[model samples]
Target: MDRYLNHHLKISGVSQQLFADAAVTAIQQGSGGLLRRANHLARGALIAAAHEKNQIVSAEHVRIASTELI
Candidate 1:
């Protein structure tokens, strides 16, 4: 969880709490919850892939994962 938070903060330049709160808002309203969950899962996969590749997580990776999931 810390890794995910740190990755998001570093890559997106947003605070962990702020990102999390926005995710919760998405869960409650926008995207009907499933998209929110899919996004979270995609983020996790991106982080894992970045870690494995020894690279900084990028928005491109997240975008591709989201597209593939959809």
Candidate 2:
């Protein structure tokens, strides 16, 4: 999960992990620990955070991520 997330994060122009611990937990639980879902959730959370002008991905961002996930 770390490797996959790192790759995606790099491609997304994120230099390092910015997900709050709770947000990480939320992404894991919310995605059922599935890599694909986790990836989508993480990406979506980044987008949500960006939309809100937040530098850190919070649990709220994770919720927004889930709602926006396809």
Candidate 3:
């Protein structure tokens, strides 16, 4: 999961990690271990973080994205 996150974020221009550990766990659980779902949630979390002007994505941001998507 960590490697997956790292590769995607790196290509997305995130030199440093954007997600907190708790957020990563939340995303994993929410994604149900599916790469496509994980990608969706991660993208949503990034948008949520950007909207809030947050430097890092938190579990709250993931929750917010989950709610908005579902």
Candidate 4:
């Protein structure tokens, strides 16, 4: 993970559980946490991209990355 992303995420003050819930939302939305295996792959790719870019993680990135995986 990029230091920049970690810093912003810390500044955002979002809890780890909250992040988990977000993942849950993605799963419920058919983004593959529960059933769509592709979604998980996409998510991993998104994290890698964001980390490489040193950017804060956002929902848009998640959506785009997940769809891209599909």
* Backbone clashes, each candidate: 0, 0, 0, 0
Worst 10 residues of 2 by lDDT: 1-10
Better of 2 and 3 by TM-score: 3
Q: Please write out the lDDT profile of model 2 over residues 1-70, one tens digit for every residue.
A: 5566678778879797888888888988899979889988988998999998989899899998899877
Return the TM-score for each candidate structure.
Answer: 0.33, 0.79, 0.92, 0.36
Evaluate all candidate structures by whole-model CA lDDT and list the values in order.
0.47, 0.85, 0.90, 0.46
| Cα shift from native, residue 45, model 4 (Å) | 5.7
After superposing candidate 4, which stretches have Cα over 4 Å from the reference?
Answer: 1-24, 32-45, 48-55
State the lDDT of candidate 3 residue by residue for 1-70, as single tens digits: 7689999978878799888999999999999999988988988998999999999999999999898775
lDDT of each residue in 1-70, candidate 1, tens digit only: 3344556557887653423433333323423446455456546545655666834444444444444554
Candidate 3 matches the true fold with a TM-score of 0.92
Report residue 21 deviation for candidate 3 (angstroms).
0.2
Clashing pairs in 2: none
- Residue 54 lDDT in model 2? 88
* C-alpha lDDT of residue 8 in model 3: 91
Q: Which prediction has more favorable lDDT, 2 or 3?
A: 3
Candidate 2 shows a clash count of 0
Ranking by TM-score: 3, 2, 4, 1
Ten-residue segment with the worst summed lDDT in candidate 4? 15-24
Q: Candidate 4 — which pairs collide?
A: none
Superior candidate under lDDT, 1 versus 3: 3
